[model samples]
Target: MTKVISHVGFSTTARAGDLATLEDSIRRIVDLGADVAELALFGEDLIAGGRIIESRAKRLVEICAKFDIRYSVHGLIVSNFMDAAHLDWQKAVAKAMLELCRRIGADVLVQHSGQMPIGPRPMRERYDALEREALSEIADIAGKAGVRVALENIFAVADTEYRQTPSEVAETVRAVNHPALVGLIDFSHGYIETTRIGADFRAEIRAMAPVAGHLHVHDSFGRPYTMSKFYYTSEAIALGIGDLHMPLGWGDLPFDAIFDEIDPLPGTALIMEIGERFEAERADCLAKARDLAERVNRRFAADAA
Candidate 1:
């Protein structure tokens, strides 16, 4: 069975340094009936004052174990391995994050595709070469640590910068072709990408499903295209137009269509990337979200049977 997890995006906020917040969030996730919990750790948690601290990493391990919850780690977005200028620093941070993953018994470490800034020239070969090399090295470390390094697809403001689309991400994962490296599809991002390009959303999910080792489960109101923009409004919020990450059914995303297109794989981690907008009622919202996900899982499983 696929284990559903919920992410606590605390690392991007002031609460990243607060253990109490982390604990409370994890407790809520478990209580919401999730099978696992994911925590995003930033570079600050790995290094400080120009030094690495195993103590801090160990504390996180202790906390997760205390609650008896299975967990995974999402490396900081700044831990980019594609850019040569910051490759060394980013690699170091990524390595430390893998160490944290090992200590926490996390079997997967989710990462964003290497940072490839938008440029004037066509740089596909150059970018692919860099990603291939960097991900290979990262994969070796993850393999040795018994963890898979999952490169998640992201929606780039410039589509050419990185592998943003589902097929593009699947291609990149195949190019790396490492046993310890796999592709992760952010459903919300995939939806936006498919909608923007007039592609079939189910086909997008099908393309990535074979290599999908993990998922960022979320919802959006409408697709955000590269050529246009939509202003935020109270009305828009109610409609869940943007990457709202509201409770599952709050948006118009075709969750059933996407799920039915592919069978759930064993050991796949589904992280509910519910944005912090629901912080005031996070517990209530998460409970509802979990219920929806469970219903979908059962429906899909029965369909497959």
Candidate 2:
């Protein structure tokens, strides 16, 4: 059976700051049969304390032991455009974070490649360099820690129109040329990233068959013109893109078919990266994700029969 990890489980945008309240949050996620609980790598507490917070890392590992829930991964390596030195600092921070992840027995780390420049001075050159830096850093940190580092796809149409194509995203990974440097295919971002690959979601996954390790599964209904904003999600809704990251059943993403498509022979796992603020709505999201996963499994079983 394909394992599902609940993404940003305890840290919805509405309550991202309240990460200390994770006991109840983790209980709910584990109750839903999720294999892992993904938490944002940083919190206000981290902000106040410092990067190498051993106390925080110890608490994370303890919670996992108490709940029998593994800490999968969640983090954004701080990147800066104006100062390339930030990249080096972020790399050190990322390495330290992965060390924390290792201490907690977490398995995967998601980091971002730098954004494109606004005025465009050799963007391909800059992005490629950043990716190379990320890859080198991942090999040293995540690989050494035995945690996978997946580079996620970013799509902000308004922000310099950077990374509007999956090919560009894929090309960056290829350039990185490291084993731990993997691809994170967030469905909604993947849709907005390319005109050619939009809605051919499964094919896009198969295209990056070699490096894709984890999936950020969410749904959206915005086309370029309708979305003039050009993207949609609970995060986007918070950003005024659409209503919200409506639960699994609320969107038009062909999730069941997508589930059928992922073989994960190369280590890819599905993370239900949905967002709902209310406990009632979150419960609904869990039920739907479990139901959908169960149904897909039954179908696969019957097909074998």
Candidate 3:
């Protein structure tokens, strides 16, 4: 029993165009006792037609190099492998993102799991197969770049018909069977999805824990969004209607129970993805994350004893 989690940190919200802001964000994360920074590279401007802009990439490297923290990249959120028409382009973007990770020395690139298909059963099956094929190729590129691609679980929304459950994502990673491809159990997403589908929440998480190499830890009441109207995110927070990304104690998620039940693989990066609105609570969130990591390590130590 050594430490089960290698890094406990927060995601940075700075955009590519604002290098100064990005530097400040990283400095704040480091000041808050975070050893890792999860860069949210979800903007379209970072990649152009499936290739990273070299100038932007170089600047990012220089900024990140100034910090003593580890790095992880959250790849383009809209790059969907399920979109059969754009699978090749998606693969190209994915490869380019992996190259960016290599350039910036990020060890993990977080990718969202495939979106649910909107057609017949056969079409859904075809999409699943396509995603696996695409990931296999992407994983090969990731391996060559010394980066691990962690497929993250996402919940379904009103517009999006459905999303893969934790078990389904785990199965996909296991099917790919590549060391460079692993599961990322976003607890908030798992809670929302399991609540939507009426599946056992803790059970779904436990099933996926064994394959988890990276984790997005945030607090969300297990409430899915509906057609109800909400003007601001604060309104959603008031009603607890969606993935609020609230601070740990701000939501009713049983984080203690979650850490008690699932043990992610050793060296997993447990990054807190608290929303930007909760910026003032960064120190508190970091402490809670450290406590949970210690709990997991204590459990492992006990098991070994």
**The candidate that achieves the highest lDDT relative to the unseen native structure:** 3
Q: Which candidate model has the greater TM-score, 1 or 2?
A: 1
Candidate 1 per-residue lDDT over residues 1-305, each given as its tens digit: 54432322221222657766676777766665556777766633656533458677667777778766677788876556668887777777778778888888888898887657656446756766777798899899999999999888776545555544787778888988999998887888877767766777778778887888777776676556433444654455655555556656667777666665554344667777764555565556556545545654676567667
Give each model's whole-structure lDDT: 0.69, 0.58, 0.86
Question: Comparing 2 and 3 by lDDT, which wins?
Answer: 3
Q: Would you estimate the TM-scores of all the predictions?
A: 0.81, 0.75, 0.95
Q: Per model, state how many residue pairs clash.
A: 2, 4, 0
Which regions of candidate 2 fall more than 4 Å away from where they truly are? 1-19, 47-50, 77-85, 118-121, 195-203, 223-243, 262-265, 276-278, 281-305
Q: On a 0 to 1 TM-score scale, where does candidate 3 land against the true structure?
A: 0.95
- Tens digits of per-residue lDDT for model 2 on 1-305? 43333232333231454545665666777776666677666542433222576675667667657877667667753443223656666666677768777877878887765565555658656656765765776666677788888777655555454553444556667776777777776666655554323546557655653466666766554333235443433445444343244555555667777666644324455566664354566666656655555554555566666
lDDT of 3 by residue, 184-235 (tens): 9999999989998899989999999999999998887889877468889888
lDDT of 3: 0.86
Ranking by TM-score: 3, 1, 2
Global Cα lDDT for candidate 1: 0.69
Question: What is the clash tally of candidate 3?
Answer: 0
Best by TM-score: 3
